[model samples]
Target: MKPEIFIQENIITIGQLLKKIGLIQTGGGAKFYLEKNKVLINNKKPEGRNSKVKNGDLLTINSNIYIVKKEQDI
Candidate 1:
């Protein structure tokens, strides 16, 4: 099964999600990271740092896959 990331908010920006998952050291790094790395949301590239990621979304960073789930669901 893919790794799961539990979030309390209804939606989170891709930047925040990257930080929450420890993919980036800080939120500011998201911009540069996104430019250098391949990040896919539900099989497509994200719009940018501000792109929205919500419950049940699939996040792909490099070769890793993560599933977004609400905190209450766990």
Candidate 2:
């Protein structure tokens, strides 16, 4: 099953999401990682670290899948 990540806010940044899921050690790493790897949000490439990620959005990074959901949905 794909891992689920709960968002307390209506939206979260791609960088923040990466840290929350332990993909990157720090927010600063998101930029380098995004540039070096394949990260898809809803099947499309993200603009950058600031790209918005909302509830129910699907994220595929380096062949791994993660689902974003509201905290209350759990």
Candidate 3:
């Protein structure tokens, strides 16, 4: 499947992004989920909900892919 794009500001935490994308009901849930699942960021499994994610970063969870993009002001 095609990767889903998440447009945000300068940056956001991994946990925050997960919640924003509806992967979790709350940011707190991200921590619990990450503990049992391996999420690949830029092709590497990064640990921590505080992991900084910026534009162009690729995240893969299970078989789904998410791409972070900076939202440009029109």
Candidate 4:
């Protein structure tokens, strides 16, 4: 399923993504997930907590799939 949030910019941080997904209990929880390489951006593991995420990005966490794309008009 798709997330209710939208990615307007070409890039976003890993922490921001996790928080949006409701995976992280608090803002700091992102650090634990990232530190353990539990966060993957576009399949591969993220380089760091501040990794950039762009359009067409696919995020998989705890078996949950999140697609980031521009909101196109129907």
Question: What overall lDDT, based on C-alpha atoms, would model 3 receive against the true structure?
Answer: 0.81
Our tally of clashes for model 3 stands at 0
Compared with the true structure, what per-residue lDDT tens digits does model 3 show for residues 27-58? 88988888888787888876788887889888
Number of colliding residue pairs in each model: 0, 0, 0, 0
TM-score of each model, in listed order: 0.91, 0.88, 0.84, 0.68
Q: Candidate 2 on 7-68: residue-level lDDT in tens?
A: 89999999998898788999999999999999999999999999999999998898888898
lDDT of 4 by residue, 1-74 (tens): 57634665667787876776576867787778887655567789877667877778887676666777756556
1 or 2, which is superior by TM-score? 1
Q: Which regions of candidate 3 are displaced past 4 Å?
A: none
- Per-model lDDT: 0.92, 0.92, 0.81, 0.72
Judged by lDDT relative to the true structure, which candidate is superior, 1 or 3? 1
Candidate 4 vs. true structure, TM-score: 0.68
Which scores greater on TM-score, model 1 or model 4? 1
